[model samples]
Target: MYQRYHPDKNANDPKAADMFKEVTFSYNILSDPDKRRQYDSAGFEAVESDNQELELDLSSLGAVNTMFAALFSKLGVPIKTTVSASVLEEALNGLVTIRPLPLGHYVSKRVEKQCAHFYSVTITEEEARAGFVCRVQSSDKSKFKLLYFDQEDNGGLSLALQEDSAKTGKVTSAGMFFLGFPVYRLDQTMNSIAAAKDPDTSFFRKLDGFQPCELNELKAGTHVFAVYGDNFFKSANYTIEALCAAPFSEEKENLRSIEAQILSKRAEISKFEAEYREVLAQFSEMTSRYAHEIQSIDELLKHRNEIHASYTITPFKRSTSKSRSKSSSKENKEDGQTREKRSTRDRPKKKKWYNIHLRVDKRKAC
Candidate 1:
């Protein structure tokens, strides 16, 4: 599609030129992950929100300038570059203002959009051994980039990107990024230096296990550049500072006391942990013993219930005294009546028979 829409090939057709621009714009958006994601989620509005493309007429430029521009663009440099190449060149030529940023002191500056501010920090060998840190704090909500320079062998300075606020977003109402210059110490007794010199070791692997020292054993003078880029479309009001990790006399004494206190507390915690484990073991043992005793008691109670069920005892009956007295009086009265009737019958039978015989004898004598 890009070849079909080549403006050079179809110079007579204006539509081909427009198609070429559209194809380039689409390619730019699709090539960048962030822009592509933004375009996918929110369409062109999000991808183009605060950014405007730089339109250059390639046909109007000289052949050499146009060739270099095309080369830079092909090398992944955005046409609307965030970091100004002129600023870097001016810095290398010593044309830009370079301020001295004292250790532990922050300097604030307002840099115009698409411009760069440079600051130099000095470090001693002793301070570098201990370590140091450099950071930039954005005073306002704006996008910017921080960079440190490395001296090349050809006496030119090369810029390395340290942090870009546009990528990280804001940490607070302001934005901040830590520029740690970690010190890597190679063991003298081993072949660690040879290992470090090994061609196969990747750059990042060599940086592993580094201590937090920003200007790690660097020479006395170094410059860091902070740039306010066109990407976010605002000037940057920010403060930058470098801090040394070396301790002062009073602080060294205080740190020693604090270290002593920390060691004491750690010992106490270790002792407490041991005692806690011992007590926990004792508690578990007691719990087991109690559970066994309870089980034994429950068994004994069940056995006693079973034995009680095996023996059957009859229930006693209780009578009142008044019912017994009534029965005895009734029996005595019946016996008295029976004896009186028997006596009357025995006396009457003898008297009646004698009287009848005497009356018969008197009648005969008359």
Candidate 2:
């Protein structure tokens, strides 16, 4: 029907031209087995890269007739047609199976590059509500483990992504391991680095030899991705993909306990600070009051010294005034006695004249 309805044959219909091109494009890819396989497996983009145009011959309409006959049979119609036209090219994944392969076959070939690796892991809300495990491994047989903490985990992934983009190729794995690119919590010194870089740190109870590097009860979002490797390993291949998930009750409880402890500590610190300030204020007030008291005592002591000096001089002054008064009284008594004796000597002559007159009267009487 493509040739019967093609715009070249039916020149008035522009819509039929579009249908003709579509039929030709499909035939170009489907007719070629190589292009058909490429289209089926990898999609149209692979076949389009070939960049071939298909020629539809009006004379050789046998295959086109057969194809329409089959399609119309399925649609309960009987039609066969072809078009004389050229096919144009155009461009545009599916099921994955998990089967266990022998370790020696697929494992040894998996090698790590000498660059910092960045991985974006998406966990669904359900996956985060339940806990998930992400497995990491190294190609260089490096021993290491993952450390999970709120403040530190996201920082590791960011640093690795930055370093991977900045480096020309990659530094040697030795340099990466030594510099602690993925941020191992374990020691990496010469003596202890060997034992400290234990690969499996997580402990599982029921499963034998089970280790769980799990993100337990994470908040629903994109989480931190990081890897830690041995300081001396040449190269290490690591995976940051979620493996499995399970519901976690203990994790929520642990978070609550930690939060309570933090709050308790903060309260204690605030209480201590308040008490310290109160004590400091009290000490300052006491110091000021005692200082004023000391000053008052000093002034009182000065006044007592002045009073003591005046008292010392006062006794001497009293004794000197008493001795001068005693001497003056004795001189005044001596002067009075001398004046009385002079008066008595001047009165004896008058007494003798009166006695002579009286003696003359007495001789007459005798």
Candidate 3:
């Protein structure tokens, strides 16, 4: 259908051009998984909200170029021929302004929508071995995509997408690219074997399914391209930077040593954790075994306290010394009086004998 309604083939027919655009539009939505899902659930409105309509004018392209573009589109690899491929070519041909991007420094540029900015970065073999990362930060909050060129088998340039900010939904304007050295890959695998390593690094954690470029593919001199896509409405003012993973080349050896030590420490930690868990289990078993005894001992102590309290005696209080002396003196005096009374009673018998004579006299007188 694309071939039949292609603008180049039907150059005289305006209706054919309209049909061609319509066919292209439909193909784009159906080809993309996200767009297709959106369209399936909520029709064109849902699809449009996420992505703008793709407009292609194949009439401006040669027959061969148009044929290849259509072929790639059918294969579900739609080519953005206008911005990415052309920008790379122009940079290589010295037709466009290519700014030098220094390592660890940011170079800022404003890129118009549907346009691209080019940058050149130099790296040494050591830096490449240690690994390098390139990042683009957008100031305008515009959605953009990063691109870089790879050498084809025929020594021609092929544009590759480094990162896309739209699908990632990270910072709306920031995207990062990293070329991981063989050593780094090996280190990662070793770490994975040593422990449960996280597949995503903190630097690119928000980017789902991010994969770094192979170190062998990265040469000493490389150019990076940033394409401000038409996904959003405005142009982007962005900064780009290239950084080596290892800050100093001499530190690479230290890094390897540290990694080995880390693996060793991780192994030690694993052993310690196992021992800790075993000890914890033993401690728990011992505690459980003694729990009933401890509780019973506590209960017995409470019972003993209750019994002791029930039998506890209240002692009588003693009087002070002064009151005791006073009471003792009074008792002594009373005792003396009793003794005198007893003595007088004994004497009474004798007095009565004397009185007997007087009593007899009185009786006579009576």
Candidate 4:
């Protein structure tokens, strides 16, 4: 159920750590010229490239790797060898584990560009948000619960119904994956570069965008709206239970569990961030310390590019083709009605209520 790349990185970038994380994030392989041709020819085994399934279960990375090795061996493709480098190890450190979200009638779309409901938000502010934005309204008194957690499961925090707009929104359940997201997580990647030009949200498209929602324009207190879609009318309206992560902070123990785990993990990440910063500082220092060395983001990128071009892989077996497969392999069951591609519900369910069970790690107060 994990969507992973064969573990390939572009290998051309100067910063192995940053590039590997970006590549691994896409479930790709790290293919530098120094690695196996089998890795390069085969490329990534795209999981429909619709990462809507569950997060990659982090605990299972080795198991997942073994599974892929078996799958690729069966498919006649072997993983690249550079997968063993420090860059990959670092990226895998952040690899998340999620169950595969189903691909049914659910349609997925990312927010290419969204103007605020009001004008106080500027383009710079919107860019900083780096989040998905969508609105789901249900009028049937059916409640909508929103959940948030880290990209990985290693963190023990899962938050339920954390609507910023609501103060007393109850924390009904934590670790309840099924009741939330009902179909798909918000697509945060800017999928269509062309979409940047058309920044309007029609009723049809807005219902489809599953990014994080914002209630900033509304009154500080609670307000009512209909959460729509998924068999409510021609669509449905769900009564939103709360707004952001602000609704529930009463369970101090769970909060502590979340904070502790995140801090522990952040400590590791912070270590790396510090190293990255130190290396950068050293490079700058070296640029001056050693008169011959060049220093700049551009110069470093070029230097990184040259290293990969000349590197060579041993024990090579080359393949002759590339493939980009889509969920089209799984046909829709209904001709008229779209197949259910994703459900925020952890599993397929007949029950309708969002049983949210989650706790979020507390960040340092800004």
Of the candidates shown, which would achieve the greatest TM-score relative to the real structure? 3
The collision pairs in model 3 are none
Clashes of 3: 0
lDDT digits (tens) for residues 1-366 of candidate 4: 223333243222223323233434445333224223434666444332442121222223565554643333233221122111222233235432222222111222111111001001112222223211223233332222223332225522222222211112342111111212222233222222122223331211332334333222222221211111211112222222222322233433354465456545645665566676679789988778676443466688998988886677663234322221223333434422342434344565665456665567678663
Better of 1 and 3 by TM-score: 3
Best by lDDT: 3
Worst 10 residues of 2 by lDDT: 87-96
Q: Which parts of model 1 have CA positions greater than 4 angstroms off? A: 1-81, 152-156, 166-217, 247-366
TM-score of 4: 0.17
lDDT of 4: 0.31
Quantify all predictions' global Cα lDDT against the true fold. 0.55, 0.40, 0.56, 0.31
Worst 10 residues of 4 by lDDT: 111-120
Per-residue lDDT tens digits for candidate 3, residues 1-366, read 656755456554535433433455576787668879989999988866313436343334456545645543434232333454455565556565556788889887777755777666788887776677676766555556676765455544456644554422544444443434322221111221112122232112222222333433355666555454633235776667788877655555565566566556656765666777689799989999799889999999999988877774773345666788899999999999999999898874445564665425555755
Candidates in order, TM-scores: namely 0.36, 0.25, 0.37, 0.17
Candidate 3 segments exceeding 4 Å error: 1-94, 151-157, 166-170, 173-217, 248-366
Measured with C-alpha atoms, the lDDT of residue 296 in candidate 3 is 92
Rate residue 143 of model 1 by lDDT.
Answer: 51
Query: Model 3, 319: alpha-carbon shift in Å?
Result: 96
Question: How much is the lDDT of residue 222 in candidate 4?
Answer: 18
